[model samples]
Target: MRPFKKIAGIAMSLALTAAMILPAGVRAEDTATDAPKIVISVGDEQKTPEFKADETKDLEISLKNQGIADAVKVRIAPVIEDANTWPFVVEDMNYERTVETITAGNEVMVKWEGLAVRPEVESKYYKLPFKITYEDGEGKQFQLDRYVFVKAVAADKPEEKPEEPKPEENGEPEGGEAGFSNSDPVVSGGGGGSESGKDAVPRVIVTGFNTDPGAVNAGSDFKLIIHLKNTSTKTAVSNMLFDLQAPSSGTEAAAEAPAFLPSSGSSSIYLDYIPAGGTQDISIALNARADLVQKPYSIAMTMKYEDSNATQYESSSSLAIPVKQAARFEFSELEIAPEAVAVGEEANITCSLYNTGRIKLYNVKAKFQGDGIEGKDVFVGNVDSGATGSIDGIVTATQEMAPDQKCKMIVSYEDESGKASTVEKEFSLTITPEQAPMDMSQMVDMPAEKGFPVLPVVIGAVVVVAAIVILIIVLKRRKKKKESVEEEDLLDEVDRFTEDE
Candidate 1:
């Protein structure tokens, strides 16, 4: 009994470890409309390509540019931080591959010469984060983090499930078994744990899961339906109880509060029976914590059930569900410099953009539209949550606008899922008509307009005449002085002659 307890503890530990290491598919955030979006695909249904252990496999990764611009100077590298998390290692410890460019509406296939999986690697879905850095056609630098899902399977993992005996020989009618059809793939003992040695113990696992609304937002209640299956073909199981929780590392923040909690105050779910190769579904209401970060969280299920012999067995499985924070924002009142303008003139428009929600606004832009004005798109770039951005643009008047005209300022943005959202704000703009040019012939015959500098010209002439009169009087006085000096000299000469006689 103690050995059985030890085995169950080992199984639970492995499940939690795998949950912490595995990655949910991807958030698939949208790039700017003019930028390139590169994604890797290897033609797997789950986006997970299978690799065998202890093999140096050659991988061909299809990198597709999903935007209108070309991705230039593209560099891709695999980020491996832990040996326990990643089953594959880089070749020659060089993790990077460079590409010249990938044009729009096309794809480039890159080959990895050697990607060696560890000899002791377990069978599971392993997503390795690939860092891609590139520039858009307009020379804007961008960095993207994409995960490549690599499904690592131990050499002895496959083909054993299909080789089991058919369940129809156990008195179950044919075609009536569609309730738990064998066609749907089930996970009995492939990842994290295996029941291969315990052939008598029936293994049950979670096949698939989905939420009601499909989009689960943080700080909201949602219904989660988990599809489970009994993989044992010959044994009928009954008296089952399942316990669910979101596995967290022993960090201070995680230990303080769980990311997800049960809405009904209990995480235990009970079920009666699932016949051989049968399936069951368990639905529960859950509330995502308000403070949970925007990411995919893993949920671990500890399933305890019984076999036909009343022998109780315990197994664990996990699945990751993505939760998103709602994107919210608001605009301040539009401020238009010179609210009124004439045709062919320009007006500057601006507004304050605030991110009011927890989600970041990607590629934020504002555009102005009206009958008489031509405005370019105002790019505000990415606005983090609780941050502010500015929307500014100069719009030129193209033609005369109608009276009491109302113009629209449209703001556009995208969420992580590539969903576009727009907001329209209306403001009044006054545009006067363009004036006609005056003809030169009409100006020639036209008299000067009223008050056309008549007083200024009269004062100018009076000052000029006064200066000329003063100059004439000064010249006459200088001539009289010269004659008086000559008369004095003649008198002096006559006096000298009288003295000599």
Candidate 2:
């Protein structure tokens, strides 16, 4: 009993001392002369602070010594309790800024820049908690915390109208992923009271889609556009990648994947980033297979993205596209400019290549081949559906070619798939033997088969005989004259000698 009484008495006395000392401590802290007034602003504008998502803004904080005495070694800093839940990012500003002393009734201002908002978040007000730590004149340290409200809105599209409000809720909040209560709105990025768990992830939803041409033609190229919306209010999504697949399942035609052309060297596209509540557009160029049935075809789209913390997520979408049938071709006429040509001579070949199918033919080319012929390839380029195009070529007959020969004309064309096909047509060629050069000596006895001219040859022979006879007569006259001159010289020499004697 004595020990119990002593213990009770000591407890009561200690309680009395605590009650008195706590009041003194509270009074010391409450004294107006020991504290300073502090204010925080965003630049010169301090009222109704607001900023857009993904924008960096500057912060200005001021400290005033409202006490009766100067405060020594004064220091202050701002802190955020929960960064993931807060709408803004706080940077370190105290390391480079400190006041040695703040005189009584004087004030000091501090500025910290580069505070940004999370992207893709809807317009809303955010409550951010901050802390300020400083010392009084008598070396008494004090710490305080407060909340600052900032409005964050979208940065672009001023003309856009706000979404309509839904009717009042009557039932329990809709269910969500595990660890989340049905009562709270689904917030994918913000770290609220109930959403602060580490497992919180972002979700991306498909809004809508469209195709460049409402209907596609078999063996044709078209474009596809897909729209996406980020449903996570607090998180910015990134590394957006998608895999576009044509339905290849179940039926025989479905067993093969749809034919998709690559864009920018790859079929899959990477968007890299999408802000919260923002929309993204993806465009892809594709080609429908030529053999596809004339009906709607299904395309499967798979999307993968990451949140602010680099957590990956996936979703899927589907679409049915319409297709039309392919084109056809027919050729009816084949003609050569001349019926006959001599060996080693050139002749023109013409053909009418008609498009009999419903579609056009592209890159039409024609080539000729024969046993002994030099043929040229012709290009008709493009022939419209139900239209006719002329394919002309020049070919030379070789020396080995016979009087009657067979030649082949090959017409090649490409389909929408870029596959090449050829059609071959056979035609008869009448070749004449090459004419032999004229010979004057053999002209008179030559056969008519040779087609040699005889009148010119006879005239040439008569001229030659007349020239030979005239030449012989002139030679004889020259010999007679020479003999006469010799005789006269001898007689003159004899007369001169007699006169001298």
Candidate 3:
């Protein structure tokens, strides 16, 4: 029994160890077989080709599928940087290109022609970097970065030659057609390597430009017309395309391109062909941002075209257009009439506004705004460029206001684009307590000064006279008693006289 238990325990330990070891081996194998392999390089003939300043050269790149999977939609482009130090620039767009497929053990080669180099660059070896992007059969994409060094050589200068004949009668030169100016061609090759006359490559030039409103103002939409001319006298250009490139650094303050302008993705216009000595005019609508400065801003234009036999070429030019600043105002000489206001009193304020920019302002208004204060807004109508205007309003102070308090005076206006702006001017306030009103009804009810009463004395005299009348009546009664006898004698005399009558 002990031997059996030992055998079973040993078998269990072995099985656990096998389970752990097999997974690591399987993971290693899966990782090794998961991804595809590819090889890319600059062609052997192009690896050490001589590069010249102010000259265009063709670059050949080769790509090979080294793994079992096929590559799909293989994209290739060149990326150059450090323009201050890099002696060469790819004059054509190198963003994207596609190849349908490259099966296992298969390879593909591509050519990038007409790369321009600076004229003043010295002879040296320069590194050119290229980016290749592709996907496998499962649509999984991958990117590879590769580079090659090229030697730059000094270009030989062209030999001096006799000048051409002047324009003859009927306005035509000896070797040129009528209406052709005797002045130098609008576009000329910068490189000294190419021979003069018929062997020279064709070029594109911007001959003239104009704006719809005759001027460009910040925050305004305007039309831009450009006249493009081909400088080649013998080669006609075909499949011509035009594009505008905006600066990335100052894009927030740059002029904007409408939907019609090819600011991104594709070219704005594609002409079937531009004949030799012919001109084409293109138009674009642009809007200047509000923050654009009052100076000339550059808009870069790039042209891509092919010659009569389908050889592609590209060139770029810039146009500097002046921009006028938008309407901007400042609060100057802000006067708070009486400086401070008393509670429950009408306060008056005035402010002077100055338009410091070239744009005009409309519906200019100023008013006093603060807690416990009320005022009306004063309208100054419109103010012209570099002009001054004044606005005044009245406000009433509330009881909550305190002495030496501070409040803001807000001046608002609109620019030519109907954009509103406000300038706040803070001023100190002196608030006083409200006075109490006088009461006239209380004065009418007030007591008179303390003194002897004349009416009371007159009443006392009437009472005394009544008492004297009663006493006199009593005294007269006593006298009548004494005079009874005399009255009887007079009565008897009267009776006798009556009988006699």
Candidate 4:
């Protein structure tokens, strides 16, 4: 009986162990069958779509469940940089469901529309991000992320636009051209919209230029005025700068002027902003040297500015002004002989004239006009530019002419421009009887001739001889006079002595 009981207990324990292990395998198979499997793809249905500021567009997302079970707790949420914190926002988001469940071989279409917040602002592109989440029957969650791009266009009325031909796929019009059907997803951010289809470059035009005192003398100041207008329909010009350049042969003279230009060359002026279809004025003061040639010189004005996207734009225009030369002249000293000439003696006279005008003199001629001047004595000729010429001749007075007779002499010349000029001078000649020449025999007592005169030595000897003779006579007379005075005084003293006794 005891042996039979032991066998029964062993059989029971083995059976219980087998039952517990078998069910665990079956439950693992069930959990595997209930696991969720999903695939998510987000894309644009149109190849390229333009959305203006504050505009909304739909994005299509395909969700599929490849497992044998159904997907549950499906949720689609867009994750974006906080528009308020970033100064840009997507105002709204809406979703459209195509089918309730994704079967083993079926797919579900989810469409979402996103709105870009419109602010009274400039231009830029905005990007919005989206994320999709779902769970299977076993409660396993899956997530997928995606993005799309839009633009913030101006709020003005829509302009007329030409229709573009639709692209063909497999040699056929895609989606019949009713609307844009297939496109890649676009991502954008910031306060402005995409300018992909619009002209990214701004256009600049040089309208006109003017200057005060259209004509100027060298070394004078003038003001240059530049006028400009913005022609781009979309861009606002900022930090506009202009360079004023004189003609190739001319230069600017002010030191405080813009230094970006040459010392005698170019200058720059600044403008803060120029809106589309708006105009602005720029003024600059210039100084030209007095020595500048007489001719028309051109002033060229160039403009440079940046667009809304920081792109550089440039343009230029030119205007011309005439530069005139100033007037200026100098005279030469007049020449006369002795300033005092004896009658019957010849006198020489000479005079010269010069032109100092900035302008050239053409066909220049000189003439002399005065009394007692003979036609042959007067000299006349052309004075070459920037040069001096003289007139010289001898004048002889008649022997019978009265003494101290004065005669006027004149000199004249014509400018290269055929202008006449004159100068006058006066001189006198004295009349005196002529003396005969001395005989050679009278010169025998003289020593060998030397340059200059020996009259100074002869005068000195005469003075010394006269001084010696006067001294000798003065000593002899003083001795005789002293003796005679002594005799007279003695007799007077004798008489005085008798009277006293």
- Across residues 1-501, which tens digit of lDDT does each residue of candidate 2 receive? 475456455555655655565555445334423123322211122343568888888755566665466655654554555666666654453434466777776777766567777776445445454555455545455544433445567567666574763311121123211111112123333223233543354566656666778657777778888777776677778888888776542225554554444444466878989887678898888887766544456566777776766556667665556565555666666666455666654566776777866556789999999886766577778887668887767666675565466788998888655678888888877777753322222233322232454434544544554465456556656877887888888988899989999
When sorted by lDDT, best at the front, the candidate numbers are: 1, 3, 2, 4
Over 4 Å off, model 3: 1-201, 212-223, 249-268, 285-295, 309-312, 322-347, 350-501
Rank candidates by TM-score, best first.
Answer: 1, 3, 4, 2
Best model per lDDT: 1
Overall lDDT per candidate, in order of appearance = 0.67, 0.60, 0.62, 0.51
Error of 3 at 395 (Å): 13
Over 386-451, each residue of candidate 4 has an lDDT whose tens digit, in order, gives 665555555543453343555655555454334565555555544444322222222332233334
Candidate 4 stretches greater than 4 Å from native? 1-211, 227-238, 246-266, 273-280, 296-300, 307-310, 318-321, 335-350, 355-359, 363-385, 389-501
What TM-score, over all chains together, does every model reach?
0.47, 0.28, 0.31, 0.30
Candidates 3 and 4 compared by TM-score, better number: 3
Task: Show the lowest summed lDDT stretch of 10 residues, model 2.
Answer: 176-185
* Winner on TM-score (2 vs 4): 4
What's model 4's TM-score? 0.30
TM-score: model 3 vs. ground truth = 0.31
